[model samples]
Target: MKIPFSLPVIDDEVIAEMMDTLTRTGWLTTGPKVRALEKEIQIFIGSSNPVLCVNSWTSGAMLMLRWFGVGPGDEVIIPAYTYSATALCAMNMGASVVMVDVKDDFTMDPEKLATAVTEKTKVIIPVDIGGYPCDYDAIRQVLARPEIRKKFRAEHVRQQQLGRILLLADAAHSLGAFYKGRAIGTVADITVYSLHSVKNITTGEGGAIALNLPSPFDNDKELVFLRALGLNGQNKSAFEKNQPGAWRYDIIDQGLKVNMPDLCASVGLAQMRRYRDRFLPERKRIFQFYLNAFSRYEWAILPPCRNDDATESSYHLFLLRLRGFDETERDRAIQQISSCEVGVNVHYIPMAMLTLFRNRGYQISDYPMTYSLFANEISLPIYNNLTEKQLQIVVDTVVDAYYSIAGTEKTNVV
Candidate 1:
């Protein structure tokens, strides 16, 4: 029963695709494979807009921040409950990060976001924690308010085109998720999806940014610039420059080198091709299995996976919470679960608790909801290939661990 927290479902087909990519001459770096992946992603997310691939979510996010002209004196509001990359993207650009609290479901609370807006506010990054979509409608309403819009200062051309604060969704976990029947990519000004090893979809290590900016902002034109921006601001990629007598190129601006390679894209493309038909369904099944097993317990606070009429999670993680458990008790329970040969994890330690953000003047006490969610949350094993027998083992291990620390035993182990 030695089950791991998460595993990428790489089949023989995925391997064969990578092998085919490796065997191709002069196609290992960013080329046709990467372009095909970008198109595949556009189809999956039901978007006709441009989707830009980058080496990592952090880099893609930071690149977008630079495009918006965020820097000193500009402030980016983000939920304190998200991964460090969310805040780091803004911090790296020399912009002030204003941390706001999250809702009970771990998404950003729009009410607090309304209060966090200021004349310096240039971006609002609402993280969709645990694969669930944020309350985007409420957040959009907040940004659209007359008072909030009046305070917005557009310092750059792109910023002026948008004419208001940007809604950049940190949707690293919610790629396949939906908000009120609308996909994540279409709901935000821009949405970045992570393709890390542990993500629902993997490219070994990469990410894609879906561009859905409003009118007067041409996504196709923006795509060409961002593609070059990712390739160190070069006018042409190595793939394009490799042509006979076409080696000459030009550099426009100082940009980051974070373009996704063809080798990684091969893996992602293979998985994405069968994602709707195979991968996503298996993950959803695993999520439902956990919900049915844990819902019977009085102390188990199950994470939300679906809301029939509203949102649906991508089933990236099954975050289970223990009622009346503090951080110390939760840690002890995790140790017990580990001893049972079952792998478990905590989603995150709030950004406010980390030294980097703390030194920047953010306090844990200021974000009470973020602290509350982080203190008792435990992420369980969930992957595409987990069997029913292994699923039961995980359920049993977690429940036993809870009672072990509580000094109580249940007669029924089901």
Candidate 2:
């Protein structure tokens, strides 16, 4: 059947929008469409916070950390089970990365996070693994502790004014997700969403940052930082500088080239227009189908989808786990499935096990739960445009491969 793992859903409408922007708009870099996309995202997520579009989530995250004044001697706590970018952004800024193990559901363990915090901790990035939002309430409770708050040391003006740690949601896998009846974008102080090709919604290669922090921290200031930092610390963007007699501008500080072009924003706008009505529902249905099929199997340990009103996933990835399969058996099963022309993959290997992290004095032995989850996890195909026949083939192929690798009798998966 040749079912692929993940594919971006694009239609004629999206293409027409992109073409219109290319042909009509003389302004391309961070122009009107980019501004429109930011507004549309803010409306879609139901947040009044200002949204800033950037080249990638990595850029957005680094900017957030920089704004918070996270530098040398400061510590940033992150879940060890996430993609390396969650921790790397902090590390790149010269901040110490404190790795915490995740719970069985693959989200950060708030309890472990509480213990990991120290006086040097400036930021805590909780990743939404596979479109599932982490327990924001639990994390808030940890931060609310008088003991934890007393240990916080302010390194910058923003840090001193805030008087506590910043909660940044690494929402690469979750855009339309919900946590405790509120949108994922609004749950944390600052939330970063990735618009990569394989994500739930894409803007070719871009990301956005949603600032949900309270007063004294203005969104306009953050936008200024994004503009200055994205354009070599220039205060004016190309569009703004194009205005009559407005060519003169000032460079505040050294920054990077990380601004999103209007071309990418056009595509993102098209996707956002139909996201809630078309994209989200289909992804949820596909996830439900996988859950229904896999639930009957004794070995299937379905990934977290919904847990009462406290949380809900955006159905980005179907992270399936085997009950007793070790790393070798899981790898063999993946090989078997691939041989059948069915594409399957893993979420991630724990950062502690990676060579770069290992060389930095991290060891897998320190994160038993992270390694336990990584050893047997496999991500199945889940996308908006996947057909019913393809879904059946994916399920059947996985079941067949698992039995073949386990030397058990083949059973009907449909």
Candidate 3:
């Protein structure tokens, strides 16, 4: 019984949408479908802010940073525990990357964040690790301090308009999540969601940005800049210019080629239509099953799934930690489970431990909590379509392998 770590749920409805897009849409590039998907996303996330679709979350983050005019000498603070994209996007813009530690839940530690801020701090990206929402209210409180806001220096019009430090939620793992009765998209100044195949909801390979910033900073203007940047500063898309007598356009700004195509948007539209009614609920059930089964074992250290009435995870990844297990033992257990045809994986290797970040002068030792979380973390399968039998097999195999490696027997099985 081979069970892969993650699989995107696809069905006849999704296929029909894709086929209709390919055959019916004359404009396959950023066309009506892309616009439709953006609208659908706005509705799904319940955000009045403009939702802009892009080729990837990395692109979306980079666009936001560029729009805010984050550049050389500016500092972009990020958690050391997140994916490389979070920090790398800042580096790409030539801003200094200020790494911070995380809390036990793997979200950015707000206290550490306060100390990391400086006059040069332009943005703080708090990652929602494993589909869990970071403490945005706590982070906001840190930024709202008179001392913190007083130290801020604005280098661009966008920065000046914001007045205080910007909170960008790296919500790649938390699209369907909620924070304090508000959707994750609405909680941050800017939230970027990944629609990659491995994510809870996928658009084959795409992402979207939900802008929740204040007035005077035009999201439309910023999106136009991004579109132009993607097309070598051209002001009009191919579809827009195709209209009779509308070919005349002007160069807006230097942009990057990162617009979402109609093909990807078609798939995303289908996924979003069924997301609330089907995908989210199924993922939650699978998450609960794993939590219930693991609770019986004294060795199991569960990931944070909920925070009273304050937050709810998207159940994107089941980050299970083993007590009394180090990196070597965790790796051994994973290997043993794989041998039993059950595929398990890790959420991430902390940026500080990665070669690129190490070369950039980051040390894993600098982030003790990040390192601790990485060492014992084993991400179990949590997808929409995984059956009860497969779920049982996954739990049983993990238990058998853990006990086998530890040379112990399971006293309690649930």
Top candidate when judged by TM-score against the true structure: 1
Worst 10 residues of 1 by lDDT: 405-414
Candidate 2 per-residue lDDT, tens place, 217-335, comes to 78777776766877778899989999999999999887777889998888889998899999999999999999999988988999998878867899999999987899999999999
Superior by lDDT: candidate 1 or candidate 2 = 1
Q: Which ranges in model 1 have alpha carbons more than 4 Å from their true place? A: 411-414
Tens digits of per-residue lDDT, candidate 1, 255-310, equal 88999999999999999999888889999999999999998887888998778766
Predicted structure with the largest lDDT when compared to the true one: 1
Better of 1 and 3 by lDDT: 1
Q: Which ten residues in a row have the lowest lDDT in candidate 3?
A: 223-232
Predicted structure 1: clash tally: 0
* lDDT, residue 69, model 2: 81
lDDT per prediction? Answer: 0.91, 0.90, 0.89
Backbone clashes in model 2, listed as residue pairs: none
